[model samples]
Target: MKQFLILAIIVLSIAQIVARPVEYSDGNDDVLAPEPEPTEIPIGKYLLFTTKANWIEATKQCRSKNMKLISILSEEDNDNVVKVIKAAGEGRIGFWTSGNRRKTNGVYFWGNEKKITYTNWEAGKPDNVRSNNGEEEQCIEIMGLNILKWNYRFCSNELYFICEEPHESIDETQPISLLFAQQILTVQMFGYYENNENEEVLTPEPEPEPLYDLVKKYHIFTTRVSWADAMRHCQSEGLQLVNILSKEDNDNVIQAIKDANQGEIGFWTSGSRTNNNGTYVWGNGQPLTFTDWENGVPDNLHAHTGYGQEECIELKGYHILKWNDHLCSYRLYYICEENTKQNLFSK
Candidate 1:
């Protein structure tokens, strides 16, 4: 009877083990999965202030931070700024840059006294439109409208601003651990993912080529002619009047002229404000993205009697290839750019 009781007890224990529900978890219940790291704006090398302040106050704030107002000297710098602004989720807001023309109207320069070589101006911007109280729109801001473009606003207007660390303070020989931290932050902010330890990592896609090459060949015409005549001649030769769009293009044109043994002589470019509402544009109707104007130029001065408005652009060798506004009827040598592959193939 005792043996039978022992067998029944064993059977009961077996039945309990089989019938009871077994809870299985990958430590999700007892051990909380580490709270995810909160998303933050990747500042990189910039300091973004969400609070609004006037241009003067913004400059003071940046100075207090031991930094300076942001100066975007290249397209990459501008893109990084846009990314930070977008991350902040501010729509239709403008941010103050270091650009200001308060010292000399219509001549924008950064805090470092460097002329703004790269520009992304909005249509009809930097108009220098005066306010009702006669306040000039001399301060530049990056507008977050349809696209990230620049617009000059009243210096007293309150707006968000960006500040940049001085290049001298940046140490390229940072510790490896700091670099790893930066990489992790980048992965988190940019949505980069990693494979599991056992899984094979996929290769990244190659970056796309730039839309246009910065370098271009040019054809210099030594014959002096009016801007209108130069345009006609270039069109007849299956080329377009050279449109200097960037510093690289300007340097290339200067070198090309030197290669032709041309001395320090002025050359007419495709830029002109003739009948364009006081704005300059290339013969192809494209707006100017870059400019190298000399000090106190484009003054629209009627230097010569009986000459029309100073509506044409000339690369004056006297100014070391700086641009100057001259009368359209003034005869000068010109440059013509080769037809692009797309243009040639299309023709």
Candidate 2:
């Protein structure tokens, strides 16, 4: 009977041991369990999504949610995005941003088509490394393990992503009274008057007469055309090739180009050496008073080499927006300028 009881006890002990749950460990002191996938982790005005997807699918998902992939426009934006990812416990997983150079390699822009002015790329990054299949790394991802710096990556790589609510949507959520007060404040700031009925009335500001009694309007044509063809097209439109005679004029022309959002490589300006004197003048016979030339530009290399005269000037070099001389036959986008007479009868 003593041997039987001892054997039964041993059997019970073995059964209990076998039934006990097995703890999992991967050579670590602390045991870890599979974590649930995170979804819609919100931080500040952005949302972090942990579900993995390729760049194209990620963009589609964000759009389906009525949001856009986040655009890190500044250092603060970068920091906030990193914080959101870290807080979600996915700091080791890269997240896709809205920046990509798919349209024009080496020229990154946000989904909204605005040029990315600020960047925090890792060393030797954005090298545009090609895959074995010859696919280029055109999309940007915030490296989760590398101090949250940006790196160009293959667009088809599955990864987590972040999204940002548009400012217009936020504004729509504001209380009506608050929006009304903001409108009143804007009216007051713009020099409005309160009538006897206590209603605000916006008083029109006196319009200052434009210089030379004419208002200059700038236009950008995205169609690639030769310098002479561009000049002829502008003339056909009752305008002239642009004459950027002042810094203000140059700035205005740049703004116009940006507004067009046509992603042009360069624009033909009305600058060329009409006479053998070697001085550049506008097609409209205006002397070149202000010049924003890129360093070592207007070199006229082709002309000197007897290929063709590089007399026609263009606003080339993306973001540099500087002037360079190219052969007249080379096709490029162009800008046109129109002058309108000021309305003398208008109050």
Candidate 3:
């Protein structure tokens, strides 16, 4: 009877083990499972304190919730926070950011003492005490009037503020089940398993090819024409006279000309003198912050015998792509700017 009881006990233990769920670890290389969806944060990830408070009080408010006032570290992050603020429906209202100054004429620092590497200050902003405004304008605020631009404000000034908190991210490098691994492999071999009900079918737009299959964002017009005539032609062609915004833009323009199999020929750019006589501005009404003026250029001398003021600039392509003042009516090769985002081939 005792022997029979022992056998029955062993059988009961085995049944219990069979009924329980089975767990396994292959001890293989640490492979990552698919990441779970991110958890949503309250106040839509970034919270805004609409209540008015001094900078010190604002810091406290954020610290109370284990968060810091928003630290914009990247352009993408800045844009995303701006979107969140817009969604908050605050119509053209300014709010405090985390950038602050501790000493006069000192660099601003983040609230959490993180290094400040990125800034999107408005034009002529952070001009502390420029108009004898108190030197105490050490705190930074996002001026809604300028749209995602920062400005210096007095720390004592009561204003709304933004805050951010850390979120827990799960480690995706955890092992997945053999069945899931097999399914993933199958999907990789084939295409993704699609459900027609969930997948929206739509025709994709055709990509626009570069001009002459050579340069992107620009078309070189080898046809000689005066600056005014070139501008008119570009307008008629839904283009604009080239505006060299940076060194990269300058290089690309030169490359486009070369790609067109054109030799070094001075091309008329949109750069022209303003009524101020001295101040030059781009055709797009942008400031002349960048320039590639040739040596002793804009001497404003007229062609042959210095008859009239040279009010226009031309890309002296043969002379190292340097710019020289030229008569607007002088005939020369020119380049036209293309809007790359548009499909030029679209019907």
Candidate 4:
């Protein structure tokens, strides 16, 4: 009976060995395998996407994950997001945020139309720098050596992004022994599991969105054309030449011009004089009560010679956005106003 018991014990031991879990190791033969690192570290209510993309592209990509691009609403939220980016070994690359301009010279509103009560612009940022032919920096991006500073850039520029969704319930029954292994596996499945230094992202970023909704519904025609042709172009598109009726209106228009970063070139408005000595009238005939002519401008001088025939008004963006008089036949960039009546804040 003792010999029989010994034989049974040996059989059981052999079976246990066959059914045991395989030992995990780094394959160094000397060191045991370390616990797997988590694929995602909970930071605030977001998951920082390590993949890079433009602002518009990032927005759609995040939405596909049932999340939205990270909108830094407060200092606390900003710090939390920065932490997550760092943990992902992506602090060096900046992430796209949800802030964008609603109107030219207008305050930036978040994607959900949240007021920008909090901002962390890098010193002298949101500069809206648009070179002579460069595009406007309308989209906000969080990029710096430290990963918290921010600056505005053209929405088409590509960069890493963060996506935030409501946190789901955590499973309390999960064993601690399996947590690390699951994390590593989950990250690997994301196709972005980079061992940090060797991280290789395999998943492609979300697709791009059209550039229409990223800015105000206004259009700036960089093509120089005679005032008559400019008016015709606007009419063709159901638009009209811009009419600056008030200081606020002028501010908005000038902001658009600056945002275009088309340099200090001239843009024709709807104001023009019937004759050199007659009053200037808006294209819409609203009234000639408002004017933004530069000091000593509308001199109505025809090229500094001959009769005073500078009949049309052009806003020179480079000259402190001041207005000047030019021949109606002179070619220049123009602003077109659409007839859409939607509320600006509806988005």
lDDT of each residue in 1-347, candidate 1, tens digit only: 99999999999999999986655556667854534433323377778877788776676677677777787778887888888787777637688887876232244566544557788899898787765434567778998563668998877678888888866643322110100100111110111235776653323333312112123569998889999999999999998899876576788888888888874778999999986999998787767767889788988877556556899999886536788998889889999998442211011
Pairs in clash, predicted candidate 1: none
Model 3 lDDT on a 0 to 1 scale:
0.66
- Quantify all predictions' global Cα lDDT against the true fold: 0.70, 0.73, 0.66, 0.67
Model 4 global lDDT (CA atoms, 0 to 1): 0.67
The candidate that wins on TM-score is 3
Better of 1 and 2 by lDDT: 2
By TM-score, how accurate is candidate 2? 0.39
- State which candidate has the highest lDDT: 2
Give residue 123's error in model 3 in angstroms. 20
The residue pairs that clash in candidate 2, if any, are none
TM for every model, in the order presented, reads: 0.38, 0.39, 0.40, 0.39
| Every model: Cα RMSD to truth | 26.2, 18.3, 23.1, 21.6
Assess candidate 2 and give its lDDT: 0.73
For candidate 3, write residues 1-347 as lDDT tens digits: 99999999999999998986544445654654444432223466688877777665666576677666777777987898888877777637677887775442264566544446788888998786522212246778888653768888776567778878743331222111101100111110111233677762222133312211112388788889988899899999998998876676788887877777765778889888835467787787665656778888878777456676677778886746788898887889988897543221121
Error of 4 at 260 (Å): 36
Worst 10 residues of 2 by lDDT: 176-185
C-alpha lDDT (0 to 100) for residue 32 of candidate 4: 67
Model 2 residue-pair collision total:
0
- How well does candidate 1 score on lDDT at residue 216? 54
